[model samples]
Target: MSLSGETIRKIREAIKSAFPNRDELVMMLRMELDIPESEVPDGSNYNLVVFNLIDQLDRQNRIPELIKGALNERPGNPDVQKVAQEINAIYSNLSDKPLLKSFEFDVVTVNAQGWKISRKRCRAQYFTEDLGNGVTLEMVAIPGGTFMMGAPKNEKDSFDYERPQHEVTVQPFFMGRYPVTQAQWRAVAALPQVNKELKPNPSYFKGDDRPVEQISWYDALEFCARLNFTINVTTQRDYRLPSEAEWEYACRAGTTTPFYFGETITTDLANYRGNSTYGNAPQGEYREETTTVGRFPPNAFGLYDLHGNVWEWCADTWHKNYEGAPKDGSAWINDNDNPILRGGSWGNLPVLCRSAFRFYDSWAERDSHDDLIGFRVVCAFGRT
Candidate 1:
């Protein structure tokens, strides 16, 4: 990606203003590109080579203004012939509407070849629509942000595993509004699995709306991989389990309370242990099984069933505490054998549903016995 000619001109002016002398500006620009000064002039020197170098810099949009400023100022000892030649060479390289910045400031869509780029707003738009198989799935658009990932020591209703809250920054992404349901699972499993062992059980919960359970992490990964291929997205961040940090962050939205809805969870709010209550709430309904997604109001971020319905898998490897965890949203997958799990199960007490709750399970293992374990997937924004 390159900068426009007008932007290049402005950049040249800025550089000249800052450096004053052409020779000095040439040396500085060379230093910036990590190119040696000895390689210029006879071997691409300032008088002979700087214009093209500045052009390249402008194309990259890294320090265009800086280079432009240097070029605009005509040195008293003019090398007019060399300057004109260099300028002509560099000018040809400018694109019609070049993109200078390497890092994407805003979301953008590029062609499959990854050449053309277009600004993308509403990178993700969620919906709840029937899959035409008598099933409905809830989807959410998750904007990226930075937040404390793990539970703090003083975190109320937090488990020992969730201690020592750590900061985490996540890139924008999209997530399913709720756990995958039994109907969705069966539909996918019915397809011939390359590995027969990976096939889902027919006897598992079959409700079209109820969250799916008895699935292993490996199974979920395969589903996500298939989905990614099907969607044909350019993003390397595929649809997969949310990291442990991401789960809690999404669950809490922005609240410090035990649950996303605040301190209390009543029967009308979520599905959890009926006998147990949090935040002075009356007992809730102990459904003893997963409920339909979006049965309750969504959190501030418009995510449904983040606290209850089923225990959701996260990408992080299990750790005793948040000590020495990564500040980024990436899972701590180093030398660890167990992946983290978050959100309380349908059978869990309200306290377990707290956003800070955390648990561990073998990554290569399965949660076949637990009817309350399920998963949702995430994809980078604009992937769809």
Candidate 2:
């Protein structure tokens, strides 16, 4: 093992005190250490020299007795005992430190050209979580950036709530590739509670990869809390729901269009109603029921089902507009109903599936949940 420079210096001092003549000390230590002449440097390799001397002294089995004698002569003299401790510490550290390991994975993204799978670490674009129990969650690494949030004026069927569009700066984080699937939700819900208990299979849909719906806003929070605990044990950090601004920022993925792919979205690109069309795009097929997660293409950030599939619950409370919204992407929590839903569901019109769309579940009926609304998870992570 390589010894610290300071440790080497202290070792040299010990050797010098033991033998005053440098040449004589070198000859004796070289023989005792069994170090070849080729390996010995004229002045350097003092660390090695010290290490061997300690080993030889230890083999002689006199260090403990020496410390005992010194303590009896002068309590805590820090002479022989201190030197022995330093030698022990240097050796101890060699066995204590563990080697670091590395891993690699892939993700998919969209651009002006089309969807492309990437294994490159270009934006540090990577997020793959295995929640265990036959349930794994895929996510995309969202690089932090500033963007103009909310639907623009003159947009088709844009609501007043989406009006007064404002800019938001979201920090880098990992967002689920799709809405929380039944399998993912069941796995998290089965974990031991942190603050509250949960029903393992709360979704109205019965499929594993299908999005988990019919869950209350409070239930979503509980699921996240359980997920936070589970992931924290694996990575020593927790997960959370994305703020409304963060959801919008990641959903846009650098696009100002109504959808991440373009000005209009179709069932081929998303899972929203197929009979209707938006912008100048042609009408397409609409599946009346929830489709499997990742049934369509992903956004530029490699996130799927952000525009449709299921309405994702955001951590923000219901707000009218961006008049006094937060600039940095953070949950705008209030005492009122604390859940804000975004991304249209399978039963909604294409207009409601716009990237800037927003909705909220009924607060008066906490237990109420429709088949149209479900949520995904987000976490502040990755090398920043």
Candidate 3:
């Protein structure tokens, strides 16, 4: 590898000190420049020698203030000067004036998997891309394991479509922590796509922090396309909607129940109807619109709004039964282009809000932004 600017500059200085003639020093360093970094032992000696030089010059009372003044003129040059001063102080405190031997040191470093730091150099790295605005998207670390994916057919409010409870193994995937917001949508809308359309002035009921509604399945797909491009996730695995099984599995966090909270759901538990005393107990506010995401408690898996707040978009095509559904958690195909939507909306009654409930919408139709239709995102791991 090529030498860093700091290393190259030091070699130039060393050559100057040894040869005295600038032309001869330049020729020597040019020859040495091709040497591999691994072959350079005492690579750190450059810093130690500079520190020692500053100490010697100061002790001799021969420090040229002109040189110090020139260094001070550069903006960040004080950092170097500060280290030089620290070295001089250490020299004065030591029994012997050997800067390297006299200095005491301790270094600590912490790193994640596949990365490490040694001395002043870092060894391994994986790129992290900023999704946009103030948000950054990083790879989520999920260990490979089996999770109970679908609800049983006999469960309360269970639909035939959720039948054939299966154990699916998800091999470590990354997902967006929050539902896609208006700002993220606009970020994608700015891209060039004729079929990709968005609200002229996208409005969230609560705010941009509230999940962006009023987007169609087609529009959401386009947004994912731009998002995939923005973060450079694999184009082969498009960031489409999550399947019914994946959504429930993530929402449940490995629990088997009618609601993640338990058999009954309350306003305190989720943002659903609470005021009307139904078959359960006391009722809550008769809110006609969707509440802000994360307004209530999250499930065991740290997923928010899986119960209420708003209905989320699913990738599967609508199906009346799960008799022949994919056991591997892939989306089941719907007639023509109709896609399945899941998680009952805010306006929905208590019976409709059950986790097993299934809904469908035409892919071409746009979301009403009625504060009842919001969305989350899913991405295949290692691919995108």
Candidate 4:
């Protein structure tokens, strides 16, 4: 009846404001909500009507197109902005994790990587999972496939460490739509500890939707453990830091470029020091601090902040090369336990964020939090 604390009502209001004279649209919308013509909508009841409509339309593949069209027509219009924000807000609040599966985008790869020929894509399928406590995580379901791991030998920025371009077959996995945010971090931190106790708020730059930083690899693991504990009780799925292979494969989506978006890296597409440029791109802004997640366009996988924003932690220990790495997507564990990190941070050079670029830190210093490092989680399906 409350419609998840009035959020549904806000979304409806936003939508109505965006399209003032669409009686035909309302007909479908009302039916989606299952609202009888005789029922008088009031207060929270307004949300019930809207939420019902959203669920029904989503299943019928009717909502995303309409929402996208309306928002895209006037993305900067105040009313349209409110509509997009409200919808995104609801997406972030649903407990089951509402995923907007769209096959409406195209795949791009570097000249070398594209030679192998990968699957075609239409839309970047995007989904979000609720973590309770009014917190949610957005994710993109990456279709499993085989791709060459590391950088190709002739890539403009290729490095020997990323060379020998080995083949890696990754299974389908749900990766966070964006890096973990302060709000999400606080929500999970409140959960009972799985290994080490987590500080409820452990970020350097404070913003609700900004990626949570200044956390160590151990902290990232603890978040995954506690998350899996709560999520698995019902879903029977495990949550953990993605293995290095999974991280790269997902970051690249189906692209073979220096960055998933294209051959060049720009601050406009990500949050990073803008004084430097890569490829033919020009230098841009230096925000000096992290920006809100999802501020930029998503890669083909419907993933945001993959190239920059924060250097994400990976499950594998630091490896000098992939000569003997696992071919089947499992993490390569090592005795030293030096943690592997990828996706470069807001303060890093553009080159560091390149898809094959790799770096590490003394994993023993799990508490050595830095503003440059953060992590995302992978929800392992059919895995308990």
Of the two candidates 2 and 3, the one with more favorable lDDT, higher being better, is 2
lDDT, residue 161, model 3: 62
lDDT by residue (1-384, candidate 2, tens digit) is 454567556645655554445465555445444444554334556555555655554456533333222222232333433554554443333322112223232334333233332323323255467676567776566778999989889777899899689888888777777788888887877664555667777766679889999877778888876554434322323477889999999888887877776667766678888787776556677778899987776666667788777888887888777788899888887787546888888888888888888876454134457788888888774424
**Better lDDT candidate (1, 4):** 4
After superposing all C-alphas onto the true structure, candidate 1 shows an RMSD in angstroms of: 19.0
**In candidate 2, what residue range of length 10 has the lowest lDDT sum?**
94-103
Off by over 4 Å in 2: 1-124, 361-367
Ranking by TM-score: 4, 2, 1, 3
Assess the local accuracy of residue 341 in candidate 3 as a C-alpha lDDT between 0 and 100.
67
lDDT of 4 by residue, 22-101 (tens): 44335433543343444423234545555565555455644433454444333344654554444444433435543355
User: What is the Cα-based lDDT of residue 133 in candidate 3?
Assistant: 48
Q: Residue 218: error of model 2 in Å?
A: 1.1
* Pairs that collide, model 3: 234-384, 274-283, 274-284, 275-283, 275-284, 276-283
- TM per candidate comes to 0.61, 0.67, 0.59, 0.68
Candidate 3 residue lDDT tens string, 1-384:
132345334433432244444343234323433323232322235554444433443454423221222222221343433433332333223232111111112211212111113222212111233544464332222234576655676675566666566677655444455566665666556543424556634655746556677666666777776554323221222356777777766666555656655555666556666564324445667676666665765554445677776777777777666667676767777565666667676766655666666776544234434456767777663421
lDDT rank order: 4, 2, 1, 3
Candidate 1, which segments miss by more than 4 Å at Cα? 1-124, 127-138, 191-197, 200-203, 231-237, 361-369, 381-384
